[model samples]
Target: MSQPVIALFTDFGVSDPYVGQMHARLVAEAPQARIVDLHHYAPAFSPGPAGLLLEALVPHLTPGSVVVGVVDPGVGTARGSLALATDEHWFVGPDNGLFASVLEAREGRCFRLREPEGDGLSVSFHGRDLFGPAAAALARGDRMVLGEEVAEPVRAEARRDAVLYVDHYGNLMTGLVPPEDGGARLRVEGRNIPFARTFGEVGPGELFWYRNSLDRVEIAAREGSAAKRLGAGTGTAVAWIGGV
Candidate 1:
C-alpha cells in the first residue's frame, strides 16, 4: 500500500526551528505517512495572499493528500482552527480566512479542530501544537482530531488583480488569470508589461507577463528579478490592458 501524503505549507522560513518542530510533531503523530514540504515562505504575516496562492497550488497536489497551511497572524487570539476537506485534498489551518480563497471558490466542508490533547499547546505556535497533528491524523484517515462542522469557516475578499506570491526566482505570481486575448498587456507598478509565451520568447532582462504553470498570470524579467525591477512584492496591484 502507498503511504499517505502529508504536505506542509507555512510562513515559517527554513532558517527557523518552527518548521523543524512541525516535521517532528507530524512524524510522532503519523509516522507511516510521507511528509512533503510544499512551501515554508508564504509571504509572512499575510494570509490572504497566502491562501490565494494555496488555492492556485491545489491542482498540483496528489489526490487525497493532507495540507497543513499556517500563515496565521492571529495564532494566539480567539480565532478558530479548521479542517477543510475538498474533493482531492484536505486542508488544516487556522480559521482566520487562511482557507478563504480555497473554500470560497471550491466546494469544501469545514470542520472545527478539536482541542489538542497529550501536550500543552503553545498559544503562539499552533502550527506545531495543533494544525500539524490534525493534518497528520487526516493523512492517516483518522478524523478523531476534527470537531464540529463549521457552517461557514470564514470568508475573504480575494483580489485577483494583485500579486499573490513572489517565488525565489523573483517571478510575480498573480491571482488573475491571463486575458483571453494573447496579445494583452499587464500594467504593474506604473509600467505596462507585455505578454510572452515564455521566457525564451523575450529578450533577457525584458519585463513581460505570461501564464504560469499554475495557470495564473505572472510577471517576470528574463535573467533578472521582476520584483526588484518593478519594486513589487506580494499584494502589488496588477491589471490587464483593458483592466482586471
Candidate 2:
C-alpha cells in the first residue's frame, strides 16, 4: 500500500505564512507526507462558498486521502474541533457544523475523533496543534479512532446568484437559466424577462437567461448590466419556471 494523501483547505490566503506553518508541522510530524493545497481563498467567513468548493472537490480525491478543511468562523467558541475518518477520506476541522456536514452529505461513511488520552492539546490554534499533527500521524500508518455515522449533518444549498462575480468587462454575471429541453424562457422578481444566446440575438437592453462556460444559469443584459438594472447580488433568489 502507499502513504495517504493529506489535502488542506482553508480561508488562510497564500500571502501569509499560516498555510506554510501548518504544512511544516505536518512534515515535522510525518517526514514523508504528501500535502496538497486544495484552496485557501474561501470568501472569508462564508462557509457557503467553502462548502461549495469542497463538494466539487471531494468526490474526485484519492481514496484514503485525509482532507483538512478549516473554515470555522465559530472556532474556539464552544464548537468542537474534530477529526473525521470516512470510508473514502478523512477530514479535520473545528466542528462548528460547517465542513463535515457538507462532506458527509455526499459520502457513505464517517467517524468523529475522540481525544487520545494523555496527548498534549492546544486550545488556541487547534489547526496547528491538533489537526495538523493528527493528520500527519494518520499518514504514517498510525491507527486512528473513528467517530460516528451521523444521519443528518448540516447542509448549504448553492443557489443561483442574482448576479455572479463581477467580471473585468463590467458585464454583470446573472443567475439566469439556459436552454432547458433545448429551448429557453426567463422570469425574475415576478416579471418575465427576454431570452437570447448573445447580445445580437436580442434587441439591445433586453435582459435574458443563459448558461455560461461553467454551465451555471446566468442572467445578463443583451449589452449591459442586468444587476445594476435589476438590483441583485450573490444570494438573490432566482427562478427558472420554464423550458423548451
Candidate 3:
C-alpha cells in the first residue's frame, strides 16, 4: 500500500507559527506520510460554516487521506477530542462540531482521542500537540494509538442558507447546494440574484449566483466583489426564492 496522505485544515492562518509547528510535528512524527495543506483560513471561531465547507471539499480530496481539522473555539475548555474514520477518509480534531458535516454526509466511526499520557500537551494548542499526532498515527495505520470508539460524534446545527466562506475574489460561497433544476433564484440582502453559468455570463459588476467548483451555491460579480457590493460576509443569510 502507498503511504497515506495527511491533509491539514485549520483556522490557523499561514502568517502564524501555529500551522508551521503542526507541519514540523507531522514531519517528525510521520516521516513516511505525505502532508498536504488543504486550507488554513477557515472561518475563525465558527466551525459550523467551516464544517459545511469541509463537507463539500472532502469528497474532492485524495482517497483514504487523513484530514486534521481544527476550528476549535473551545480548545482549552472541556471540549472532547475526536478521531473520525469515514469510508474514504479519517479526521482528527476537537469534538466541537468541526467534523459534524463530514460525519453527517458519510458513514463514519467516531473515537474519543487519547491524549499522550505525559507529552505535556498544551491547553491552548491542541491542534499542534494532540490532533497532529493523532492524524500522523492514523496516516501510519496505527489505529491502536487512538482511544475507544464512540457511537456517534457531536453534531452542530448548521445553517444551510448562510454564507459559509468568501474567496479572495469576493465570491460568496453559501452553505446550500445548487437546486437540481438549476433555475432557483437566490435572495440575499433583499436582492434577487439570478443564476449564471460563469462570471463571463454576467455583465461587468453584475451580481449572479452560480454553482461553484465544489457544487455549492455561490454569489459573485463579473469583475468585482459580490461580498462588497452586497455588503455581505461570512454568515450572511441566503434564501432560495424559487420552487424546488
Candidate 4:
C-alpha cells in the first residue's frame, strides 16, 4: 500500500521542540504515514499571510494529502478544531476564523471533531494531540470526522478597493488601478488618488499608487517607502476609483 502523506503547516519555528513532538506523536500513531513540512515559519498568528501562502502552495502538493495547518493564536480559547475535506485533500486546523472564508471559497468540506480512541484531547496543544493523530489515523485508512459544513466565512474588504504588500525593496505595493485610455482614477482612505505606471511619472519624492505584474494596485514612493509614508502594510485598504 502507498504510504499516507501528511503536510504540516505551522507557526512553530524549528528553534523549538513543539513541532518535533507533534511529528513524533503522529508517527507513533500511524507508522506508515509520510510527513512533509509545508512550512514551519508562518508569521506568528498572521493567518492572512499564512492563508495566502497555503493557497499558493496548494497546487504543488500531491493529491490525497492531509494538510495540517496550526496557526492558532487563540489556542485555548473557545475556538474549535476543524477538518476540511476538499475534492483533492483534507485541511485540518483551528477554526478560530482562520482562513475559513478562503477554505469555503474553494468548496471545501468541513467537519467538527472529537477525540478518537486512544487519542488524548488537549486544548492547549490540539495540533499535537488532535490534529497530528487524527491525520495519522486518516492516513492509516481510518474513517474519521472533524467538522461540519457551514456557510461561507466573512472576509476582510479593502478599505478603498486594494491592499499593499511590501516588496523586498520596501515598496508599499498598493492596489490602485491605472488610468484607462482617457485617464485612471483611484480612491484611498476616502480620498481620491491617481495612478502612475512608473515612479518617475509622479513628482519627485511624492507618493503614488499603481498596478503591477500581479495587476493588484501597489502603493509606492517615487524612490521611497509608500508604506513608511502611509504607515500601512498588507491589507491596507485602497479603492480602485476608476480604470479601464
Best by lDDT: 3
lDDT of 2 at 122: 54
Structural similarity to truth (TM-score) of each candidate: 0.95, 0.66, 0.97, 0.65
Instruction: Give lDDT tens digits, candidate 2, residues 1-244.
Output: 3766888888888898888889888989877778888777654665665555465567677778878887767655766555655667777776654464356455444445555557455555666767777778778877564456455445444443444344433344443335555345555666666556656787777777665654446667767777776665455556555544
lDDT for 111 (candidate 2): 44
lDDT values for all models: 0.88, 0.64, 0.89, 0.68
Candidate 1 overall Cα lDDT vs. reference? 0.88
- The TM-score measured for candidate 3 stands at 0.97
**Which lDDT tens digits does candidate 3 get at residues 1-244?**
3888999999999998998899899999899999899999998898888899999999789898999999999988998889988888999999988898988888888899888888569989998899999998888888876788888677776897999999999999988889887878889999999999888888999999999899999999999999999999999999988555
Q: Point out where model 1 deviates above 4 Å.
A: none
Q: Against the true structure, whose TM-score is highest?
A: 3
Candidates 2 and 3 compared by TM-score, better number: 3
Question: How many Å off is the CA of 19 in candidate 4?
Answer: 1.3
Question: Which residue pairs collide, candidate 3?
Answer: none
Give all candidate RMSDs, comma-separated. Answer: 1.5, 5.0, 1.0, 5.3
- Give model 1's clash tally: 0
Tens-digit per-residue lDDT, 1-244, candidate 4: 3978999988898899998899889889888888998788664676655565466567777788888888888787876667777888887887655555347448776676666566466667888978887788777877655445545432322222435346655565443334445246655555565667777688876766666654545666777766666666666666555435
lDDT of 3: 0.89
lDDT of 2 at 100: 42
